[model samples]
Target: MVTPAYRMIRIKNASSIMKIIGFLYIFTIASLVGRTIAALEFNQMMGLFTPGLYQTLSFLALFLIMFVGNTGFVILLKEQVDQELLRVASFDDLTGILNRRTFVLLAKQIIAEHVKKQKHLSLVLFDIRYGGDEFAILLPEANEAESDRLVERFRLSAVQAGIPEIPATLSVSRGVVTIVPDQRTTLETLYNLCDRALYDAKGNGRNGAARTRIAL
Candidate 1:
């Protein structure tokens, strides 16, 4: 039973506690094998081997198994709950992308890193007004041409991969802004420019891309 339980834990890629318990099961098997070999070779039970001591060890082992099982279950459940909460807080329920608040928080750090590295950064915004689906992509060390190519690739892929529920192919309009970020550059400024470019795409007619370049 312990062997199978350990195998199941390994197959499931269970928590650290479960893995530790599995290792303990292995230790138990080794000890049991060593004891059996000693008993068979000696042709008599060791003087120290008493039925009462054996019973005590068995009870202690059972108590340990119960304690570890219950405690590990609670720890695993708590970890699962924490991961769920983090997912719900950090991602959009509908789109499964980073929510606006989480993006803003992480974008600040990304902007700082890019600025320090003196690298080009591109921000792309895709807004489906009718469906209320929005996506933002940040490309570090990407120039205007690279960003444009990526935007076009995404648009073409969306057009080619038709949604199962929709009768027609998906139309994606994107706004791209590429810049060599500096200390003065802010995420809000980049976002506003990208949003303006998105409107430009919409004005030119949907299913298109508009790109802007900032010197700073």
Candidate 2:
């Protein structure tokens, strides 16, 4: 989730940079004009230079400043943009859940650790039907407040339906949940059970929760 504080910081940085850029642009233009005028006066008074020579010198200086300043500014902007994009990509924007990429990586790590310890481990994959498309439609029709309310309701249902005995950790993406079980279950059995439960939830309708059972 993008916290209010972080958003504020981003806005502040953006505003500051825009102001700096604006000032730089104005200063550059003014300097160029002033140099041209000064050169023209010196040439007229002393006959040491021509208008073309003065203009060329002024243009080269202006072009160099523009090249360096604009290049640096563009690089900085790209870095900031990339950082923001990475943060957004790592989590679900709507429900503030960990995205699928994060879930997969976490699952693999946990599974490897459990295997080393000779403990049982399981993986459960869950999906909510049409959740992505449904949210896209709802987001425009309803305001963020309303959309949040809808997401919260579904999240609450899921949490309440979670099986406490399983020692499970869950990561949610756009419309999917991946559960990593600790010490208590076999992967194949738990997956089948959870998958069936998920199907049942889907059968009943969206916005519900279901869990797979451990096979004996």
Candidate 3:
């Protein structure tokens, strides 16, 4: 979740760079204008060199400073923009839950480690369609007995999680797929199995849960 504090910190970081860039701009302008006027008078009196040549060189140096500062400022701004965009893409705006893409990505990372430890992994999905809802529960380490219990509980309690966009409370069907990770196990496969289970629950009735375990 993007907490206020985190957002504020990002804002502060971006603001500080903008301030630096602004100061550099003002300083660069002031230094060049003041120096050029003085250098012109000095050259006129001395009659020994091209008018404003020294000021031009100094202006280039100052402009370089401003240019570098602006570059840094742009980089900082881009970093913040990227972070915000990633956050938005990864989380569902209405439910504040991990979006499907993010969930699959993180779940895969978990599976990679769990497989090394020979641990069981669970995947639960909630489907809210047909104005009804259901749950799908997957327990990779769970036998039929354990999955049955969890599925029953989900059937009884699973509700359609609401978002601000919708006013009416909808129902959901839950689908679960459990698997022991191996060479053939993939995120897409898991999602597909779970999604199928979700449909099964919907076929039986909305507001129900289904469980499926992949064979090793």
Best by lDDT: 1
- For model 2, how does the per-residue alpha-carbon lDDT over 1-216 read when each residue is reduced to its tens digit? 124224434555555544544545555556567665775775533232444544555566567557756875786688689878987988788778667677656655655565456543333344533353222111222323454455456576655665679765332322222333455534344345556665666666645544443433
Off by over 4 Å in 1: 1-26, 29-65, 129-133, 164-166
Candidate 3 lDDT, tens digit per residue, 146-191? 6667766654553445667978665656787766777667777877
Per-candidate local distance difference test = 0.77, 0.50, 0.65
Q: For model 2, state the Cα shift of residue 80 in Å.
A: 6.3
Per-model TM-score, in order, reads: 0.72, 0.31, 0.48
Candidate 1 residues 100-156, lDDT tens each?
A: 999998888889998889888899998764675768898878888888888888888
**Model 2: lDDT to the true structure:** 0.50
- What lDDT score is found at residue 46 in candidate 1? 41
User: Against the true structure, what is every candidate's RMSD?
Assistant: 4.3, 14.2, 10.2
Which one is best on TM-score? 1
Model 3, residue 24: displacement in angstroms? 25
Candidate 1 to truth, TM: 0.72
The per-candidate count of clashes, in order, stands at 0, 2, 19
